[model samples]
Target chain A: MAEQKQVARPLSPHLQIYKPMLTMMMSITHRITGVALYGGTLLVVWWLAAAAHSDAYFAVVQGFFGHWFGKLILFGFTWALVHHALGGIRHFIWDMGRGFKLPTVEWMVRANVIGSILITVLLWLIAYGVKS
Target chain B: MNEMSNASNMKTPLKRVRGFGASKTGTEHFWQQRATAVANLPLMAVLVWFLIAHFGATRAEVIASLQNPIIALLLIMALASACWHMRLGLQVVIEDYLHSHLAKFAALALNIAIATSFFAIAAYSILKMSFAP
Candidate 1:
């Protein structure tokens, strides 16, 4: 037979082909939140280093965190941490060969998101409540 | 069951399992990732709790909190496990997306360095604060 023509074929199952699902969103968010934790971790490390040096330095650090922008970032960081933690639990359960049922998976994903938001809000509420 | 026969057979489950096969490191990596994550659950909870409890604490107040042996110990453990888990997690991310060998190598190396040194700095601060006069 003659050599086959070298025609470039379009790839099937294109990137945007699939409809979005909760499970898919959860997987993506888990990774994105995991990476975001690094920034939050660095901020905490910086805070610790400053606290070690002197009260003056620590106060300067606190001032930044007290600002509206810093507070917003910290809130997001807390949410990320909470979301990732719950997602980690979901994986941990799967690693044990359980919770593979569709219903269970869907339930866990929903809890991972809703629980993180609730817990983070509760934490900040307690923080501000105690502050007053 | 002798080694000669086993070697000749080349059908042992162990041999079948390297590369994913004989080495078995793929599953080993998976287990380690989960282990660090499990360790993080409680340690991170404690760390978060400690932070909230000390949200606006002054230097002296904070130092006193760290000075408690149990608190410092938990903080150190939290940092160590967290950073270790962070390195493992990022390694997977780097390996997945970076198609180029050079890019993967650089990112993995940087991930390890940053994660390890982050724990060092964090733990040191906790210790120095705890031990100060």
Candidate 2:
């Protein structure tokens, strides 16, 4: 029997060889924010359950959230949620067989980033405004 | 045994290719994720509007609104579907991106644990709300 030789085939373009573009960055950020959103959803459940369980439980959670660290994490969670939500919309558009063109992809990435930041800022403003 | 050997001998190596297996279940996951996202389109809108309406309300009103049986049930269903969708999407992502088997296994385990924990918490919260006075 002859020895079988392994042959190398052409590889597709991936993240390693090429410089990261905005669309690629947006795609990866969408997944990371998705993971973050999973954790954030747990926090929401905790808050809701506490509110449902008893006054004492609610008080404990509220007290913790009132702290600076909790506020910071909440802010981060808000950003992740908005970012991921817009990313989902972007993917939805792509799924509809659109947005793959160069201009549209670039514009969508810019929109996702800018829209997420804008929404997060707006949310924080409303949150703080309500607090005051 | 003789018939099985004959069948095996007649088959080509490519017949054993590992795509979707005999059950054809992979597409169900894809379908469910899309279905849930579509469902979530409306659910999310309602949820956001509800939150805004309850934004300035007292804690009592918030609890009362959540405790409503329809809303409570919807929330439970939404949470479960959302978690399921998250697991499916994240699994595809990990499979596509993560090349290291060990790292992929750990990430899969972490994703499962988080999904399970969140589901449990949401279920418990729904029960608590339903039973709350």
Best by DockQ: 1
Instruction: State the weakest 10-residue window (summed lDDT) of model 1 chain A.
Output: A7-16
Q: Which candidate is the best by lDDT?
A: 1
Candidate 1 backbone collisions, by pair: B17-B21, B18-B21, B18-B22, B18-B23
Per-candidate TM-scores read 0.90, 0.75
> Stretches of candidate 1 above 4 Å error?
A1-5, A8-14, B1-10, B18-24
- lDDT per residue (tens digit) for residues B10-42 in model 1: 676665555464445668777788888999999
DockQ of each: 0.69, 0.30
Please identify model 2 stretches exceeding 4 Å from their true place: A1-16, A128-132, B1-23, B48-61, B97-110
Clashes by residue pair, model 2: none
Q: lDDT tens digits, residues A70-109, model 1?
A: 8999999999999999999998899789999999999999
Q: Cα lDDT of model 2 overall?
A: 0.75
| Candidate 2 per-residue C-alpha lDDT over B1-133 given as tens digits, one digit per residue, 9 for 90 to 100 | 5333465386544453434555457468767777877776566546544544544345577677877888877777777877887887788788878989899999989888888788788788777767677
